[model samples]
Target chain A: MQDAPPSLLAVDGLTYAYGARLAVDHIAFDVRRGEVFGLLGPNGAGKTTAIACLSGLQRPAGGTLTFDGAPFDPVERPADRARLGLVPQSLAVYDDLTALENLVFFAEMLGVEDPREAAVAGLALAGLQERSRERVRTFSGGMKRRLNLAAGLVHRPELTLLDEPTVGVDPQSRHHIFEALETLKAKGHSMLYTSHSMDEVERLCDRVAIMDTGRLLDTGTPAELAERAGLPGADLEATFLELTGHRLRDEA
Target chain B: MKPRGLLSAAMCIARKDLREFSRDGVGLLLAFLLPLVLVAVFGFIMGRVGGGGAPMPRVDLALLDLDRTEQSAALVTALLASDTLDVVRPGPDSAPWDEADVRERISSGEDPYGMVIPQGYAEGADLILLRDPGRDLEEQLVLMSLVGALFDAGGEDFAWEMSKRGLEASGLPPELTGRIEAVVNGFRFAVEAMFDEAQANGSFDEDAAFGGGDGADDDGADGDGENAGNAGDAAGGNAVGMAEILQLTLPLELVDVAPEGRDAQLGYQVTHAVSGMTVMMLLFSLVGFGRSLLIERDKGTLVRLLSAPVPKSSILLGKLLATFFTGLLLVFVLFGFAHVVFDIDMVSRFDTLLVLTLVNCLACTAFAAAIAGWARTEKQADGVSVLLILTMSALGGSWMPSMMMPEAAQAVGRFTLTYWSLRGYQGTFWYGQHWTDPEMLQSMGVVLAIAVVLLALASRLFRTRYVRT
Candidate 1:
């Protein structure tokens, strides 16, 4: 980890607003290659907003974003999309199409030469090869999450963004998604994982960032963050609760 | 902009959309099957009303008999003899012919004709004829002539009986009565001769005016002489010629006849209606497609796709192209269905039809995209698109011909996409009408212009919404 190269995706002083409201307020973060970086926050704490900006869905009002040493401009951005992927909060895979077909479609959009082979490989990697021919609507929550991840990976993207990929999912599906993320990490794929589950952040993320009210409260390894909050023996969840407060965020 | 990359991306989106569309059986059935079912149901109903075999004009009449005499009965019988009139009696026992009922039926488009008979019609010296100015003139004439003939016959018999009684009361000599009869007969002969000469001269003048040259007059005179000579040779030929002329001239005198070479007029009307209806419905699919963009944005699929190497223009272009192709396919399917089921002529002026269809489809697709671009959610897009489409279809002459609409309403129709689409379609099937005809060309141009503007607006709006600043 110490010998790893610097962050491949970096956001500096990023700010975004929706009309009169600032969604993400001067946030800053970096995600290193081959590392699982988690953004942990309550709903509407700007986790999704920050990820949206990074994923080129929204432009920052004030800040700079770079992907792999290049400034990111969505309009001018070339088909570097082939190197990046996202597993949306909802099972973005079309419910009516077979898992294989969804993967193939995304793969083709990413300009993969052999979409079928890529789809098969992705399904195998996500441990969804058995259900490749089944429509997504028939799949369980866990299977859908796994297939969603497979669809993202069909293009063999270098970086994958997971936006609450386990929300409302069954325990088994949550476990499967974590395992799949681990596999992707093993293959040296960088990831930006956002979720509200402290335990998930502790278990899966190599580095964690806690945020509230569109501002990053802290960033470090789970244990390091705990120590910084002056709780020597406390877990990451306890540290997060103490720093961000236990009150639920009333997101609009 | 790698063309291959853009093509591949567009194909991907298209393939996905089509697959999803096909897999949602209920949705597909609603989009395609439901409209066709509605058309079939309405078509059958219209067929029944227009007559099961062919469409024919219908006239409604109300009869009143104050005299309760044989003459009145004969007049009513004659009125019933006409195939054009559907005579209805007016009374408590009969069907009510209230103004409310008449107006309601006419507004609801049940029938275009109505008539009223005054209470003292039989006793009056002149029959009070009430006519719907909106109805065909020929229909009215047929009804009037039947009643007139009955009254004339009765008046003649009454005059003859009066004269006989007067002579008997005076005890006049048979010779004096016979002389009076001869004078009346001579007057009748002169009047009849005069009427015949006037009719022949009227026909000759009409021929001369229309013929427009000395050459035509020579031909007409020669033909007339030959015809008269031939008439002398064959008794049946003369009778047939007279009968044919009466049959042709009688209808012409009553109705403003459509011009010759207009055999495809009905086909043109049907095509216009079908095309307008198709454009209106295709909006549904457009809304569905546009909503997918919102869904993607909310679910992060758009971000996922954008983060990949795909160019923004390629992504947008792909979506637009997919929509355009789908719209084109929909139009083709509708035309094909109409042709096969109704025997509507679709292949006439193939190039013009194709061009018109393509242009109209582009406009529809562009408008749909614009709607999608403005909407923040799928539901908003769906609702707005449906409302807009329904309003446009109604105002654009889908249910009735624009010519039948009030002048102000016809002007309003020009603002709707359906109007332009209908105009283009009508030009395609109707003969002697070129695409370059000012009205058709103007409509097509407007549609194309709208497509261009809408497409530009859609692209701009989409970029503004989705692209990173």
Candidate 2:
């Protein structure tokens, strides 16, 4: 077998908690360079918390996260931070501004040398070049979703953390967003995507990690997870059901 | 973080915020238009005409004529003809109201001011001008009108009485002094009638009342202040001349005095209202600006911004800078409005005003940050800010000067930033003192200190809410 690509992101003993409640447990994983890593969990399963910690939003209570071989504090290292981008679940965009303007503003904040050129390139990546000059308030849900994804990639970050980018998107818009993310993956952009949908993980993620109650349950390829669950002829969803059980999540 | 990067991030955030504000037309209206109207209305209603035009403010005086004598009539007509007093009288056929009823009308807010002419055949001379105790300017103005009327009504009688007292002290025979008094009374009555005529015709002269009136051809009673020898002719024993009578009648000359370099010019009437309004509107604007934090929180913009590589402190700094600049804009707009609408002299003390303006802006931004950090929701922040602004304005002498308020209230006012801001402006505008003057500097220092402490507390609270918590 060919030697595997070097690990671009390594999480060792990562743990985080709110006061009196643990949101993330000591869990470790390695994401190879240019691979899409899916973190699958149910509601209140610490998937979002892991993403938050990994994106440097929340300080991990007990963890060592090393990106590109050495650990760095995002607060103290703006250059390192500029290399990471987060696309949040919420539509984090200024409604009053045009798509191009919002992209330029965020791009400039990330220390991009030529923000205008990056904004235009970002719009093209999201397939929203024709509507770049329109205000976001006047855009449809899917269009805004596309713009939201574009905003995270404005600076062309090396590692992108996507927290439920398709949470509220329509079927057609979801397909468009997935295609755009796939295009980035083709260009050697490593992404840590958190989701509850097994179909999305199986179709898009190169490797998968299942976590619940702040602890990691398993980590393998979709076929490997299926085989490990003893469901030989099953797809990723059936294998996931067998491993996690059919109980209601927190939202249920 | 590099300074240039921090600055670039701040500018980006500020530019985004400004774009958001410009899109909100209604909020813009409240920020700029509302203050202009408020300042104009309050200034026009409460101020006098002495802002580079008329001599005095208008007083609303109601006349309750118990003494229907010509003396009272002359006083009433004179006051009505002049622009100083707006004389109000009952209908011609209306029944005479009691003194208690007149007092009730004024005390119960039915009338602004009332004057009672007691029926004592002009002997009592007790002219009571009824006024509300809440207003100092009104009381002082009525007293001044009374003095002016007194000069016209009983000038000669006062002079004759003074001459008679002098004759008695000089040891003149009782009979001879009595004869002098009789002759003085005849001439005094004639002078009073002449005054009445002069006032009715609207040609009332100040010099005429001091024994040098229109008919001042009585030997030594001319305008040059010479003795006419009228008292000597009447009193064969000891003469009390018209000049002596005038000297006794008007012992003290009321003269207007100003400082050596600074002229004591009459300040614009709306000055108090403008200064107080500036502070009040700034509070409103600052609170509104601070609420943007709550808005971004609700909208998830803050969280996303924090997630970026930019330092969190830079975000706060950008917002503070934006708020300070907006406040400066408001001050320029308000002062411009005051200068154009009410003829307020803003340029005379531009340096002092600018310092006070900056202090107010800093204080406002500090308080805004504090409130945003402590408040959980936009609604909570807005409600609390409104209550605090109104309370500060009331206690800090926005409606009236703190000197006119009760001692307890004045003491309470000293704790507020509003109080210090008002005092700083008043020192420069009303008292003609420079910003470096002792009292002015002290007030500005207090405001600056308050701003610094508030900023420190706000920073702590902000960190707790955004970072630690």
Candidate 3:
């Protein structure tokens, strides 16, 4: 009825290459406000490169990225990247810092004058309020994953990019991660989550894009992707294999 | 949250990095402990330098006995008998080196002091000291030994030359005067030889002898009480009565003051050691800081910061500032350690020392930043940094004095940052040069300029490889 909240981001004709090997070729996508967009691909896919271009960490060979109907040029200034947040697949937080301290530091980095309150909120969001004083080095893998997520949210950017946030965690930890994302969604933050796990994607993502090598194959809702693979009633795994192929990707 | 400025971001980053560094227990231990242990080891090896002066300290002299006359042999024997020096001569099978070669050897610190007796040295007893200009104490000893020998030879020449002329005009028979003159010259030689013997026994009270005092005795305390004065008086009184016919001798114009006053610098070995050790430690610190850049990228923190509301340059500046402060802290700690443990005079020229330290830290940080920018991985950065520090230390006068090094090696050393640092330090502390000296200022400026240029280059070369799959 409200025109389904305007698109918070727009991307078109994005291209990136490693040497002469093209990794992301003329890909395009959009993320609506307060909606979770899933980016899925197998290993060696262009998912990471695409995310890099979107986050302003790498320059695209060609294309444009717009945020909130405004041109967002990462090459211009750091403020261009201020509206975006990226949680890398690897743990990026300092291991020596305590949970609250980590939150405080990240919050301050984003220009928060008093980070204590935000840090506290982040601790709560990550379900680590009780372990606020503990160093991340001593944290469990799940705890670190949660803290990592907490750090990205400290700046409270309009768009958050989550890259394999729960890849190596236990099921219980995975549940915690899902809950955290759901909470962010409830707070009206758009997310771009990358995952290989079909169930997690099915449960959280409103729409998904599947890519391989350097090109996006298709993008749609869970049922739409299933049908796009020509298996109208099949699950995401069948659809993913149908689109991305069953052959294994090369390993270095 | 409000958007942040670049400076604010840099501060936050610096604080965070410093905090992280502080928590690395082994790193902190090595940072603090390594310098202290190194300083202790060097100090112990150098041992305590001599304090106060010892009268007529035993010196090592390289002597070339070119003169083969009996008189020349007698002079050498007198010198050996007068134990002020352990006279070093060429081995029997060794070839004779020229006076120029001896001078070159002494200047290179291959030999401390040397003298050459010319072919006709028996004629007038004129000797040339083959030495660099900066040999005050040594020069005086050489002069004293020469004076003792020359007085004997000159006294004989004076008596014979005068007896052949004046005694004949006094109407004495020439034969009779020659015999008397021979007796008088022999007695005079005996008298001078007695003084030489007293010197050899270390019982010569040289101060009491001349009252020109302490020219012969570097310190007055070691000589036998009144013995040198008594001997000089007795010998002079005896020689005066018989050697009335002897001709007057030339003035003993000895150059006892070092032309450059550089002898004092040789005593500041500890200061030189501290400067060198500090340079090496600062270099290690630079390596650590350089590796931190790669580590940050590997950990994704650098990429994450790029997304923050601050310029990309701010990220580099932030890390550099952090490293600069860290390096500054390490430098202070090391100097403090040296001061407390080894009694190195770090605070004597506190202001200049502080400025040099900051400049060195800045240079080292910039150097490390460039290495980080150029390297593709942490291991590459580590290896390159270590190799650089080792090579620079070895070639840049850190392990030894540049003065002792060969001319060509010294020339090459001028290109290393460590050379500039040591030069500045030695100039300031050892040579007692002021900070306003052109050479010192130039050294500082060059190091600072290096920092600026390298930092700019590093910033240009640096690009995050954040999109790795």
Candidate 4:
């Protein structure tokens, strides 16, 4: 059998908090090289907080984040920061700027060698080259979503932390985004994708980590997770429900 | 990162901000246009109401000509010409009203004071004044107006008699008083002799000799020193001869010694309006730029920026640079408007003006950053900025001259940046002082110091609000 791919990033006992309340509680996971690792969780499951810590937006209260076989603290090391990219859940583009302008600006900010060329390439990657000059305010939600994806990739970082990137996308735009991600995966890019869509997670992620209330419940491929939950024919969703229960998590 | 890289990032961000701001056409127009309109309106109103252009309120006085003589009619015309009185004549030219009519008006409170020319007034009969007892201020005003009219009517004789009476009231030793009286008589004789010679020559233009007519200077005594000196030169020997004659009549001599060449007309009201409105309005503009920080955070652009490889200081420095340049533009725009509309002398002092304005803008930019850093939301920033800015403007003499405020308030005004900034500006523009002057340097130094403290505070607060978790 082929040896498992070597790890590109590892999180050991990662923890974070907002004042007295813990937002990310001692969760650990790893993304191997050329792997699309999925972090599946419901609302308030600490997925976004973990992503924030990784992106250097929040300082970890206690934990170790190792990247490329070395100690990683993006907050202390801007070089490490430049290696990682964040696609925030919010539509973070300047509405007044055109698609190309937003890409170029973010690209330059990320220390890309040639921001203009990268921006053009990013626009094409998101299938938005035809509308690159149009202001984001004039774009549809799907188009904006696509552009937001392209913005995070403009710098071509090794690891991209996408926090619910397809939350409110139309199916057509969603399909295009899936196709783009597939292409990136083929190019040996690693992504830490957090999503609520079961089908997309199953189809895209190489290995999935089921999390709830800041704790990781399980980590395995879809079939292995079903077998471990003792429901051999059940899908990943059934395993998630079985492990995390049917209770609603609506508050953070 | 290198200093150049940091500055480059800041410039890039400022360019982006300015480009976005440019697209807001209505905001751009209102930013420059509203202050100009306000400056024009405030300048005009203050000029009129602050004793620059308009006369004080006139008191109404009723008149009844009982004597109906040439002298009484002349007194009536003089009273009508007095700026202090609104003369109300009782009857038409065909028939005049009696003293009873004048008394009735004063008693009924229809007019505060009334003048009645007694039956024998042309032959030195005294004029009777009818007045209401309660209106003391109005009564005094009317009496002063009457005295002025009487002086104009009597001319040289009235002045001579008044001076003699004043001398008698002084109760000086009889010998000294008599000797002084003789000197005055000689002066009167000398004046009559000069007049007689001028009349003989037919060269004495009555209006020109008395400094009357439209060609007379506004402040006939002393206006522009250069113009006055020129007039003294043109008058030459006649003016010298008149001065010697005038000196002989005086118990205490008066000297017309003023600075040789000083610009007394500094356009003070225009200066106050321009400086006050510029400082106040620029605060509002810079604070609005500060509010853009909250806006960017709300719009999530700040998050994207923070997540990038740019240093956090560069982000803040970029915002500061943007606000600084924008504020500088606003200051020049308002002053430029004043220059065009009010004909204020901005060109001569442009260098000092630019330095003072640059420092002022830096202070304002720091203030903007502080406000943005302190407030959590756009609405909160708006409310806080208005309250603080207006308070500063009022306390710092942006609404009026600090000298006009209560002594305690003026002392308090010294603590505000607006006060120092306006003092620097007023010194440069209104008082014609150079930037190297102690007071000007002090203002610049204090403003720079305030900018430093505020920038430090802002940097801390921004780190807490935007950078740290």
Candidate 5:
């Protein structure tokens, strides 16, 4: 009915491999302006590989990525790359640096106007303002996760790529992070969120793409995907199970 | 990217690295204090062994006097009175230091040096020098001391006898030998007459005899030219100078041609210790800093850096800058400590030292970055870097004098940065060469070339392994 929000990032025929084995097999998705897009998969389902390709840490074998109505290749079009912010799955903040120092360094890297001011603002946004001066090495996993998110957000790019941002965090810190993401959404920022948690994806993502074994299985809204799975009114977990199956992914 | 922007990013990264390095107290101690302590220990040991104001210690020589003649006794007393040798002789009751006993002593390594004055030593028999091999420098000193003792004890007689024996032993045709012996005898006669005149007169007319009566142009000319002047004076019916006559007959003076104020042996060992340790530890500390890249990759922070909006080269350039600055500081600190503790004259050659040190640090920084970039893991980096650095240090004469190595090993040492670095410092401190000296420039050029090659390799490795993925 209503026109889908104009796509800010569009991918087509994206492919990658680790040697002979395919890790991202011609999969495609889009994150429209001002909305959260989710990529859902099991442990070895290539979600992180897709994120790595999008964030320029990797070069895909075959793909045409479009950002803001222009062809985007991070290596060739670094200005387009500047519009992206990537939060890797690992806790990537420097342990020896204070929270404020880490944020400021990232801000400087991203060419923020005033690194200290942006760092302070990022600290407040992550709910880590009180401990900004303390080294990240002393922080709990949850606190570090929060600061990690804040570090990624210092430059406030148009699209934030968050790969399993809630991993290893306490439920309270997860709630705090979700609240921060919600605030960014309220501010009209876009995000591409990847995770294994169906509930979090159902709650935060306006659209979802389910992948398995490096190939996209489906993409739809939660209710639409549930209905398509023959479970109307069911939660996203039921639809996820139906699409990706119940096999133990770690063993695979 | 703009140059300013690139420089800004690089500085930002370098600052971050320096900050992190500063926070690791143990690392700081290892990087800074360890070299100082090692240098101090090495400096003290080298000073005691072969340095200090004295160039070498007094050598102990076993003396076997088979002649037991007045000339042999005079030789023994002169050697004993000399500063360079401690003459060890048999006691009155002991068997008189036989050649067999001394040879056995040398062969068994109980003593490494011995000398035998044969029964005909006073009658033109060759004196025997026996020693275990592998002590060439000490052997030279012993030879010099023996010659000086001979000159002191036997004077012109010993000189004439030794000359005649040398001429006869040369295996030359008898005709040539006879002519040489005749000329030598004439020169000896002239020298004896000059000595007698000098002994009779209270003061010898040195200028009239040696300078051909001009007295204005002596000015310490060469022996040949001074001999010509003495000839001219003699043809003019003037007396031949004693020194010129002796110079023609026996040119056996031992002169140290080291730089005016510096002690050659002491300065050489000091420079060897300082530059060797400094260059070796630079690779250690700089590569240790470069290993931060591997640490960041393991911690996943490298991915974040790649994801940031900066030219990828800026990161590596930042590491290079940080490493270079750190290495420079470490070098200056070590040298400063050496200056304070060992009294090396660094201030006199500060400019030249700084230039060489800057180039040396750059080469080391490039080497560090290349190792860090090429290694796939920290463990691999550690193992490879240690192996290469230690090998380079040893081959480059860091552990011992390159001259002590076999000729081929010394040739191989020329390829190592440590050798060139030590050579440059030796040029500066020992030979008193300035930075613009050709040898110093060659050292800088070779080191700079090594840096360029390593930097290019590092760039390729970083691109493949970290940047492009």
Candidate 6:
């Protein structure tokens, strides 16, 4: 019998807590190569926590994460991180440095041998080649968001994790970021994309997982979840509301 | 870990930090321009204070001439010609021969010496000199002695003129007058010789000659005269043995005399202060840079870096190196300003000063890192850093000379980097002591040791506790 193809990233029975309160509770997920997986949730849902845990930022209280069949220890195993990249919600790129410098710095951090070439390629892919030498401080919020996404891809990691990468950006930059993500998908790069925008989930995600209160509420293609929730021919937003209920989850 | 790879990562972090800092205009200004401004201001103030140059003492005098004779006026004019005494005319109601008023003025401690030429003073009466004992004793004594010598010579001239007139009246020849003067001097010499032998042999208990002190112990009797001679010798040693020249000019020298000992040259003092303040302010740069760690961590940049292949240790080391280099750069800028503007000598004992500055920079970086480790926000780090820097400046004698402070305070100041740095700098330019001098070497050792301990503590704290999970 031949061994099964390795999952690009796997998180099993993951659980994490903030103080006495549980933030990520036993959430299970896996991303295969060439798959664009969407983690859909409203604000304060366990989306960021799950991503943090999967990216090895937080140690799961009770779970195991493996990348390409290798056990992941975020603190000790720096080699595991070479295969992963994170584009945080906030623009983590240095504002005082130029766009190219920012990309090169991140590339260097990820152990890229030819950071300049990697930076140029990443900038070209993000359509920021012309603005590569401009300081990020001068860039618009949307432009900065696009540059942040490009910075994450400079080292060309196999698994990229984007946590709310498109929030608060202009529609133009948001479009650019989505187009870039789709292009990456076409190029067969796997990604774990988390966002609250159901339309984005519907458009970009090959498979969508709905999470609320640290638990996976549902997991399937948008159409399948919509059908399972009995919302015939409805968009993901209506189907999500039907499955998770209408009450606000503002109170902890 | 591969050495080359680690070096590459460290270099990358350093390059990134340098780029960011270079582009940060406000940071550059704070790190460099502010210290230059402070040095300029301090230098101006120090120059105005006439620091370590000399003391300028002023004196006033009042002279009373009762005898309106030409001779008496000439004698008064001679006293007025001296620069040490600023001669002033007496008030209208003042009697020219009023001994009471002269004594009052001298006793008031304003005029150091007062001279009263009594009635018939030029006609061979003794002049009375009043001196203020409370004034500088050397000035008072010198002025009194000068007046005594001048008047005694005047008396001798007056006596010769009177004898010439008497001889003319008696129809005696000049040859006969000279023979009679020789006979009188011989008789006087014989009496003085007898007195001198008696005084030397302690056979005479003449209280008047010895000022009431017994001459029984000749050695003890000679001690006061020896001390006076020694003081005269010291004063004479500074210049050729021209006592008259010293008396005429020493008063002027006293007006702006530098404090004895401590090598308090104005240039050295100003440079020392500027260097100290530079070190102090550069510590803030470290705090400022270290606050970036807190800000980045809070903003999730630290998390992002950690999420990459960068180890946490590398991240911390990168920050430490950045802070250290920034501090050193700040020192270079300050030293440059000191060299150009204040004319601070840099090359003499350069190794020692360099070692001192580097150690201080390390300590400052470590201190900043420790503060960053404990602080959770930029505001807290800034507030605490300013407070610490100010306290250190105060304790380190940056504000004032530690020697001028109370002994206990000075002792406490020894523990501060500013004190040791100032001492090390003074050792270089002021005392001209070499870096290998035991005292300077010891101070350097203490400062470097402190830097090591602080760095270790800061590194441990940063590594073990500062990172939030």
- Using lDDT, rank the candidates from best to worst: 5, 4, 2, 3, 6, 1
Residues B21-87 of candidate 5: C-alpha lDDT, one tens digit per residue:
8988887988888888888877666664444443345677888888989988899898887656777
Q: For each candidate, what's the DockQ? A: 0.54, 0.43, 0.43, 0.35, 0.40, 0.37
Tens-place lDDT digits, model 5, residues A197-237: 88899889999999999999988899998888899998999
Candidate closer to the true structure by TM-score (higher is better), 2 or 3:
2
Tens digit of per-residue lDDT, candidate 4, span B1-469: 1112567767777877776777678998998888888888877665543433334347888888788888888888888887668899855564567778788888998998888888898777888988888888676557666776876787777677678768878997778878887999899989999999999999888765443322213343554442332232222212222343343445524343333322333346667878888888888898888777788888878877777776767788888988999999988888888778766667878999999999999999999999999999888899998998888888899888988899998998889989989999888876677898999999999999999999999999999988885
Total clashing pairs for each candidate: 8, 3, 0, 0, 0, 7
- DockQ-wise, the better of 2 and 4 is 2
TM-score of chain A of each: 0.94, 0.96, 0.96, 0.98, 0.97, 0.94
Model 1 sits at an interface RMSD, in angstroms, of 3.5
Candidate 3 off by > 4 Å: A1-4, B47-213, B216-266, B341-343, B464-469
C-alpha lDDT of residue B302 in model 2? 76
**Ten contiguous residues with the weakest lDDT in model 2 chain A:** A72-81
TM-score of 6: 0.71
Better of 1 and 3 by DockQ: 1
- Give the chain B TM-score for each candidate: 0.66, 0.72, 0.60, 0.69, 0.72, 0.57
Ranking, DockQ, top scorer first: 1, 3, 2, 5, 6, 4
The residue-level lDDT of candidate 1 at B20 comes to: 75
Which candidate leads the pack in lDDT? 5
Better of 3 and 5 by TM-score: 5
In model 3, the clashing pairs are none
- Which of candidates 3 and 4 reaches a greater lDDT? 4
lDDT minimum window of 10 residues, candidate 5 chain B: B227-236
Clashing pairs in 6: B54-B256, B54-B257, B55-B255, B55-B256, B55-B257, B56-B255, B57-B255
What is candidate 3's fraction of native contacts? 0.71
Instruction: lDDT for model 6, please.
Output: 0.72
